[model samples]
Target: MTNVYLTARFPRIAFTKLETNGFTVDYYTGRDLISHSKLLRKVAKADFLITTLSTVVDSEIIDAAPNLKLIANFGAGFNNIDTEYAKSKGILVTNTPKVSTNSVCELTIGLMLALSHREVEGDQMMRKDGFPGWSPLYFLGHEIAGKELGIVGLGNIGSELAVKANALGMKASYFKPHQLSEDEEKAQNVTYKPFDELVKTSDFISINAPLTDENHHQFNAEVFDNMKDSAFLINVGRGPIVDEAALLKALKANKIAGAALDVYENEPVFDKKFTKLKNVILTPHIGNATVEARDAMAEIVADNVIWSSKGKEPKYVVNK
Candidate 1:
């Protein structure tokens, strides 16, 4: 029987599935994976390891797990995992992709609506009994209907956002490494534009690109300067894609109307300065955090463990 170690709490469905297959599973929850050195010591003997973004699986950690056959990530982004080091040791790494697309896309739209309408601010004011009477300019916000929306990437989440934006009477334009086909363009009603042009012409900009070496700090002072003064920015993608310092400056200087972010450069540890700004809406990286998405991701991780244990191909192998 294979022994599996879960570095963080996952959906119970995964544990039940693995147990049904005669695998011994042990997990620790409600503890910080980074700060807990004893947990990694226990992980050293496990045959399969299931992890979340909170945990780091580097060369030293992988070396500790000599019996490890697989490392299954319970989310789409495996940026936390050291894939090169894992592959060098012939350890299979897998991630759950496309499962959380709709949930994340929905959150992106939610952030856009909330930021544009000042939803959070309004809610807080109402709760504090500060809503005296309706005034002509009471919480006046940017209009979303028939506005130009620029998407940084046109992948699953970005494309879904495009569809939703179109339905809300917005024109969709995207900038990606590759161009979309004519059929795809017509279906989503997305026009491919140059990055610079998209930044300059858009009334609202939403970033859905992945974090890569080329895309790191993709949004900086120059890009913010090109945006319209009334433009709003929303990022549902990786944190490091936008330079944190540049974003703070842009928001403070009113270079753009406002910004909404679900991820940050140093996630789970936000910049102290961001809390002081009222123009920005921040979420604790809950893009793919829906209950359904979490369960689906857990099932994917379980499938990877089962498949790898049986010498079969996993559904979403990252190392391969």
Candidate 2:
């Protein structure tokens, strides 16, 4: 039997299909994510390795797995894995994309509304202490309608956000490495702007870009200083895209109005300072936590492993 090692917990429904393909699949049975030491030992003899954003597939891990032929990532972003190193070792890498677009977009807009309306703060105060009755000026929040929204990435999730933002009476604009064609922009009802222009003008800035070497820490102290003091920042993208320390400084200084984030600079162990702030809304990277999306992700990753195991190319190869 071909040895296949999975570094994280996944849906068994998908694993059954891989099991039928004549591979002995193994995964972490612990309540928490598997540790790197444990993962190193498990993947030592793996023919195929299934990875997650939490797992770091560095050069050391790649070199240890002499039988490893493929690294099938569970999410759209593969930055966690060292693709360059993997390719140099003649291993294929694939990611499950498009399946979580709707799920992530919904979370992005939800965060926008949450930050604009101070939804989490209101709920927390209500649950912790009894209401002191109604007042003329109580629980005030910024209105979402008639606001300008700037999207940082115009990919699948960002484009969908624009469509939803327009329906909600917000002016949607975007800045991406690649600009859309005139016809595409007209259909989406989005205006293109330079990155600086987008930051300075938007009432709410949403980041939906992937983490890349060029744009890592894309939103820093300098970027925050350029933003409007009343603007809200929302990031449903990778954590490293925003500098955690800079974000903490901005929040403490009230440089921006407020911020909502689903991903953190150091994931699963984000800065403890974020919890003390009243103007921020933090989530545990649940941008694509919906059941439907996860099941589809499981199916896609399983398909990648199955196809590649048979010497056929997977559907979503990133390096090729």
Candidate 3:
């Protein structure tokens, strides 16, 4: 029987499934690993290591787990995992992809609407018990209908947002390395534009690209300068893609109208400046936190661990 280490808290169904597979599972729920020495001792014998975004699986941790044949990540983004190191050791790495596409896409649209319409400000005013008489100029915000939306990456979530944006009477444009197929292009009705041109001409900008070496800090001061002063920015993808300092400067100086972010460069430990700004709407990385999405992701993680333990390829192998 394979020895599995459950490094994070997961749904009971996933745990039950893993147990039924006749694996010896050791569970840990505390954010801290008790102690690095103790964790190294426990993982030294682990055959399959299952983790979440919070856990840092670095080279040192990998070296400690000599028996680790596979690493199953519970979420779609495996940026937390060191793929090259894992591959060199013949340890397969897998992530749950496409399972939370709808959940994330829904959050992206929600963020856009909230930021553009000042939904947070409106809610706060109502909660303050300050029900003053409504006036025409009271809390006026940008309208969503008949606006130009520029999407940075045309991946699954990006394409889905385009469809939703079109339904709201917004014209969709995207900037990507390659253009979509004719059928896909017609389905989304999005025009491909140059990155700088898209940033300059858009009424709203949405980023849904993965974080890679080539695209890190892609949105800096220069990119923000190109954006229209009336445009709103939304990011649902990885954090480091946008320079936080540059974004802060833009928001502070009113270089852009407003911004909404679901992820941050140094997440869970964000800059205090964002909290003070009313022009930005921030979320605690809950893009895929819906109950349905969590269940699906857990199921995928369980299946990946089971199959990989049996010497079979997983559904989403990162090192492949």
Q: Which stretches of candidate 1 lie over 4 Å from their true place?
A: 34-36
- The better candidate by lDDT, 2 or 3, is 2
Higher-ranked by TM-score: 2 or 3: 2
Q: What's each prediction's TM-score?
A: 0.96, 0.96, 0.95
State the TM-score for model 2: 0.96
Off by over 4 Å in 2: none
Q: In model 3, what is the error at residue 33, expressed in angstroms?
A: 8.3
Local lDDT at 23 for model 2: 79
lDDT of 3 by residue, 1-320 (tens): 68988776788878899999998888786865434565666788899888887567878889999989898888888888888999999999998878788898888888878888899978887888766888998788888889999999888788888988898899999999898887878877999889989999999998899888988999999999989999998888888999999999999999999899889998777898898898899898899999999999888888888998777888888996
- lDDT scores for all predictions? 0.88, 0.89, 0.87
C-alpha positional error of residue 165 in candidate 2 after TM-score superposition, expressed in Å: 1.3
Residue 50 error for model 2, in Å?
0.8
Worst 10 residues of 3 by lDDT: 31-40
TM-score of 3: 0.95
- Give one digit per residue, the lDDT tens place, for model 1 in 1-320: 68999987788899999999999998876655544475568777899999887677888888888899999988777888899899999998898889898898898888888888899888877888778788997779876888999999898888988999899999999999999899989988999999999999998999898778899999999999999998988988889999989989999999998899888888877788987887889898899998999999999999889988888988888887
Q: Is candidate 1 or candidate 3 better by lDDT?
A: 1
